[model samples]
Target chain A: MSEERKPGEPANEISRRAFLAALTTSAVTATAAALSPLKDVVDLPTLEEFLRLHYKELTPEDKKAILERIAAQVEKDYGVRPNVTDPPPIPGVEFGYALNIGRCIGCRKCVYACAKENNQSRNPQIQYIRVLQMRKGSIDVESAKTDYEGEVPKDGFYYMPVQCHQCRKAPCVKACPVQATWQEPDGIVVIDYNWCIGCRYCMAACPYGARRFNFEKPEIPKDELNPEMGYLSNRPRPKGVVEKCHFCLHRTRKGKYPACVEVCPTGSRKFGNLLDPDSEIANIIKTKRVYVLKEEVGTLPRFYYYFNL
Target chain B: MTLDRDEGSKRIPLAAAGAAVACLLALAVVFTKDLIGKGPGRDDIPKLSPEYADPSTVRKVRTEMTFDGAPCQACHEGAEPLQGNPHEKGIFHEHIELKHGRNQHCFNCHHRMQPADFSNFDGSPIKLDNIQLLCAKCHGTIYRDWGLGIHGRRSGFWDTAKGPLKTQVCIACHNPHWPIFKPLKAAPPPHINPRTRAKGGKTAGAENHGGLD
Candidate 1:
C-alpha cells in the first residue's frame, strides 16, 4: 500500500488511483443527473409533474395511468393493494346539516375520525372545522374564538363552529392555477389528487377560509380504515395536494345522513333537500325563521338554520 | 435674512403636519381593530335582524340558501350531493359526509376574525369582550333552547327572590356538529292532578297548587 501522510499534512501529489477515484465520483454524479426525471427524458415523470394535474382536467386515460402507478407504489411501499373506488351516489337524497350548538360537548372525536377517513397527510394534523367559545352579550367572535388564552367557555362564554360554506359561487375555483378543483354536474366540487400542484392559491381566494394542503404522506392503520370505500371522501388523500369537503359524495350519493348528523345526540342537525316543499328541511325553513351565514357575498349556500325562539 | 424667514416658515408647517399624522394613525388603529379580529362569516356587525333574523311572524324568510357552486370544496372534505332533494334543488349531507365535514380548523373560516362591537344577530356588541352573540349567530336553535332554561348545569339554590337566571348559549355544554347529548323523555309535564279544576282550562298546574304564585 502507498505510504499515508501525517494526520494534518496536505497531499502534494496524487497517485493514478486517487485521480481515478475522483473521476469516478464526478462521472457517477453526471450520470445520475442525466437520468433524473427533470432531464429531457420526457417519458419519465417528476413528482412535481405528477402533482400538477387537476382532477377535472385529467383525461380518463390519465386518471387510469395515475391510479395504476399509485397502486403499484402502494404495493411496493406497504405490500398491499390500496382499495381504490369511485362509489355510486345515494339516490333521491338531498343533503343538509343542522349543528346543535346546545348539545355539542367538544370532545373532538369527529375530528380524528375524519382525518382517518380522508387519508389526510401525516405531518401536521388538519381538521375541517373548529368550534369556538364566545362570551354572552358580546358579538366578539375573537374573545371566545379558539387559539385564545385561558380556559374554555369562561364564566359567560358559548361555543361557535366555523366551516367551509360550499358557496354557490366559489372563489377558490376562480383562483386555482390548475383545474384541479372543479364543479361536478351534481353541483359538488371535487379535487383531482393527481392534478394538484399544492399552489395554495385557492385557499387564499376562499372568503370562508376553507381548504387544506397536505405536506406529507398519510399514515393510517389498516384496521382503522373505514372498510366501506368512498372514492372522494374516505378514499385516502395523497401528499403535496389540496383537499376539502366533498359532502361525503360517496355515502350521501348512496342515500345516508352524514356521520356527524347521525351521531348528534340532540337532533341538532336538520339535513334535506331544498327543492321539495314536503322535505323536512324545506318545511323547517318555510315555517320557521331561518338564515344563512352570509348573504351579501352572494355565495348562495346550501346550508340554512332555523330559530324557534 | 430671507433664508431665516424661510426656515422658520417651513418648521412651523412641518410640526403641524407631524402632529396631524400622529393623531390620524392613532385613530386608524382604534377604528381598524374592530374589523381585524373577528371570526369568519361574521363581519363588523352582529345584527341578525339587520335584515332577516326576525320579521313579522307571517312574512316568511328564505333559509335554504345554496352555496353549492362556490369555492367551499378547497377545505371541505365532503360536499357531494347525496341524492335528489325532494324538491331536487338541494342535496343532503350523508352520515359519512357529515363525519368528514366536521369543522375543527380556524382557516376553514374566519379568514379574518377581528375585534369589534359591530356584530350581527341579537345585536351582540362586536367586541372581543362580547363573543356569546357570535356563537348565537348560526347556532340560534341552541340559543333559543338556552334562553328557555333547557341548557347549562342548574344551581341547587331555591331562592325565589331572583327572577329568571340567564340561560347559557348552546356552546356552554355541547358542540354544534359532533354532539354527545343522550336522548331522554321530557319530565312528564310536572305531574299534574288531572282534576284540579281550572274551572275553565287555564294552565296545567292551575289545580294542584296550594302554593302562592
Candidate 2:
C-alpha cells in the first residue's frame, strides 16, 4: 500500500508543476491583451460610416457621438431639429396599444401621424393603419373590412381599428434570422431597420399582418418633414425594411403618449402599466370584461378592448 | 412481554400532547373575522361590444360632414371591372366634365350617400359598386396606370410586385366622384371621450363628420 501511494508522487508533482506554469503565462498574456487600449479604431471616416455600425457594438461615447451627428444632420435636412434617442433611466419599457372600437371615426389621422412620426416620405402610398368599416356582428376579417371612401363611415357599421398589436409574446422575434427585431422589456417589439435586409420573414411571421414594406423610396416634400425622430420606432426607415407600430417609444419613454393616441379625438385609445394594479386601464380591465383581439393565438397582445356601456 | 409492556406504560401519549397544546394556546392569541367570498373572472375594462355605444366596430355609419362633390357612390356605373383580364378602358381623354378635375377630395368622390344617392347630369342614378367607371370617363391615363398596376394599387393573390392596390375600383383608394384621395391604409383616430381615453384630433381637410346633407 505504501509503495502504491508513494510511487506516483513524483509523476503527480511533475504534471501539477507543468499545468501551473502554463496557466500563469496564459493568464498574464490574456490580462495584457484585454487591457490594451483600442485608440486608433475610435476615429472613423464619416457620420454615414458611424451610422453603419451595429447598435450593440457601439460604446456609450460612440452611441452619443453617433446620435449627435445624426441629430445635426437632421437639422440640416428638415430645419426642425427634433430630439433624438436619449437613453432612459427606467429600462424594460414594453409598449402596449389599446383601441376603443366605439370611438373610431375612420378619418385616417393615425395613419398620417405615423407617417410624420416615423419620417415616412410623402409618396401617399405607405399604409401604416388599416381602419375597416364593417356591418355589425361581422367577424370575417375580409368581408367586414371596407376601405375609406369620400363618404367615410356609413350608417349601420362600427369602426374597428387595426394596426401592429405589439404582442407580448411576439413570434416575429423568433422568426428573425439576424435578430433585427426584438421585444423590449417594456413590451413593444421593434425592428433594427438598419440591420434588417428586407427579408420579409417578419411579414410572414406576424399573425396580425402588422408589418409594412416600403415598395419605393418615400417621397416627402422637403419642407414637410418631422425632424426629431425615434431611433428604432420612427426614424426615417430605409427602403426594403419592415416597419410596425412601436407605441411611439420616442414619446412613451418620456411618459408622453404616442402621437396616434394623442391625436385621437375620441378617447378610443388607452395606455397604462399592465403591472400596475391601480392604473385606470388596469381598473377598467378589472371592473369590466376586457379582451385582446386574438387571445386564441397566444400572442399576448398588450392592446386590450372593452366596449363602453 | 413484561419488559416491553413496562416501556409502553412509561411512554408519553395523548395526555402529554394535550398538555403541550394547552400551553401553546396562550401564545396563539387567535383572532377571527368574516371570510370574504370570491367569484370568477375580473371586470376591469369599461365595457364590451354589445354594451359599447359606438356601433362603428359592429355596424358602420357614414359621416355626414364632407368636402365638395362628396358622393362617389352616386357614380357607380354598374359594370364589373373588365371581367377576368384585370384591365379596363379609360375615359379622361373623351370627356373633360368626367375628369376628377380640381374638386378631387374624399368628399368629391367616395362620399357616403345617406338614405339616397345623387343623380348625374343626365338624370341617371349613380351606382356605388362601379365608381371606377365614373373615373374612366375622364382619367383614362390614370385608368391605364391602374390597369398595368403602375398608377394605383397592384394587389391580389399572386402578384404583389407593382401596386399596393388589391382592388380595381377607382374609388377603392381614391374618391371617384370628386377625386381627392386618402391612402386606404391610413386610419384616422377616433374622437375619444376625455373622461376615459384620448385619441388624436382632426386629420385631413374640413372635418366633415356629419350625416350626408
Give DockQ per model, in order.
0.01, 0.03
Best by lDDT: 2
- Expressed between 0 and 1, the share of native interface contacts present in candidate 2 is 0.04
User: Tens digits of per-residue lDDT for model 1 on A102-137?
Assistant: 444343333333444455433344555545555656
Runs off by more than 4 Å, candidate 2? A1-53, A79-82, A89-94, B1-213
lDDT of 2 at A26: 51
Q: What is the C-alpha lDDT profile of model 2 across A20-93, one tens digit per residue?
A: 44445555554444434344253333756535667667778876876787677667766777677844423533
Task: List per-prediction Cα lDDT, in the order shown.
Answer: 0.46, 0.53
Q: Candidate 1, which segments miss by more than 4 Å at Cα?
A: A1-83, A88-94, A147-155, A305-308, B1-213
Candidate 1 lDDT over residue span B1-213, tens digit each: 233322222222234444544555454554444434322321121111111111111122223222343433432323332234323643433322222145553322222222112245433234333344555666676455444333232221111122232223333334333433332221111111221222222331122232112
Q: Quality of candidate 2's docking, in CAPRI categories?
A: incorrect
